[model samples]
Target: MKRLLLFILLSVFCLSLPLSAKAEGLRFGVPPWPGVTVKSEVVCQILEAMGYKTSQLEIGPPIIYKGLTTDDVDAFLAGWIPQQNEMFLPLKEKKAIDVVAINVDEAGTSLCVPTYVWEAGVRSIADLAAHAEKFDSTIYSIEIGSGMQVSTEDMIANNVAGLGGWNQISSTTPVMLSAVQERIRGKKWVVFHGWQPHWMNFQLDMKYLEGVPGTEKLVSNSVVYTVVSNDFAKRYPQPYAFLKKFYVSGAVQSEWINDFGFKKIAPEKVASDWIVANLDTVGEWLEGVTAADGSAGIDAVRSRFAN
Candidate 1:
């Protein structure tokens, strides 16, 4: 009778623990960007090493913002600010989300044209005016609501790029890339939004046009950050701290983006490979960061990964 009572007590105690205590699954949100997706996977793998199960909730820009506000999502690794300033400000004002840390600052979105366009002297925003006919009087952009579109519209509205009359066409990134590829194949003139640390840069020999005198030219240092829900830190302070302390260098992220973008390697494989080789770097992220259950950080990660 005593043995049975002890067994029953042990079972009851185990049942009382939170499911997260039994299975540390962290839900991370990812947008369609390759770098963001890849980095999130890398972080998730690291968390998994600490006995946490990580799941990605893929969402568009608007949905991601909504998820954070509703606490339907835990975190997003790709929060590009300043560019995303308009979107984040309202949420911030409402105290719906928290900016965790600046992850990679070596990236930017800018207007770029083919090398041929540069060769033909279309070197600046002002240069586009002369070749408006060649560009079909249209500015190719990614998604309709993306920051690039917003910025492009602003430029057109303000008549900063001599593109005041140009039409902005919205489409998915892949579609825009395909259009670019078509133009590249025929060596035709095209002007579109571009960014660095992306596969497109590696895949194509392109040039970012210098901004017109009064307009802001997109350049590097447009830092991408990590964002979490306002309730995240409060509910899971330990994991939140780990995320806050986490930092992935520019070179590291660029390399991963290059590999995934150009080599066409699977994201999971890239993530797994990166995690295994960069244990030391990842160790730094775990510094002073404990597991969700309050175990030794390094030990928990090591045991989890090594197993």
Candidate 2:
């Protein structure tokens, strides 16, 4: 009787050990922007190589913040600060979500006009008010719940730059680009929101409008961050360290987005190819890091991607 009891207890302990040691999977929140989607996919791939199972959930900017607060999301790699100031500030004060690190830097987000429109004298955000009729009294923007949309709403609410009655026509990035293309095709005057690290900059001959005297600098900004749960650093030191060291520039993201933007390739494939081609850079990301299962980081990644 005693021997049988000991054997059963040992078997249960062994089985429980494996269950308790299993790494928690990740549920990542991704916004609907080409640059962000591509970047998030790359990060997910890297994390997967490290042995963490990642799920990408496409939620709006607002929902991402809420998700973080509710513990419904594990991370978001597309947190654009200052632009996303309203969403993060209050939650941050409550100790809900934490800013991990800036993943992509030297980014630009603001209103712009075709170079031809600038030639016709709409070279500034303030210039739009006077040419409201030409622009249809509308400022084109991305999805309704985006940070850029919030910024646009603030501008209208505050009547910034004499844009009191201006209507914001909300659309997706592709639709906004189509609007720009239409204006360009007809040589019409149009003012709309624009940003850098986008294929649009390459596709369209457009220029950013100068914000009002003190605001121009703010609109032409950079650096979108990787934000994780506040406890993520303490609970997952290796992943945190790897994310902190993970850095990519606007040029890198723009090129990748452009590659898929013009031609149709999987975002994951682009990221994998980038990883394989830039093994030296990725090696640095994996330095001092280990797989989710505690295996060697670089070796695990190489083998996983190799297959």
Q: Taking the candidates one at a time, how many backbone clashes does each contain?
A: 1, 0
lDDT of 2 by residue, 224-256 (tens): 888888777887778888888888888898888
Report, for every candidate in turn, its global Cα lDDT versus the true structure.
0.74, 0.76
What clash pairs does model 2 have?
Answer: none
Return the top candidate by TM-score: 2
Candidate 2: segments with Cα more than 4 A from true spot = 1-24, 213-218
Count backbone clashes in candidate 1.
Answer: 1
The list of candidate 1 runs beyond 4 A from truth reads: 1-25, 217-220, 304-307
Per-model TM-score, in order, reads: 0.85, 0.87
lDDT for model 1, please.
0.74
lDDT of 2: 0.76
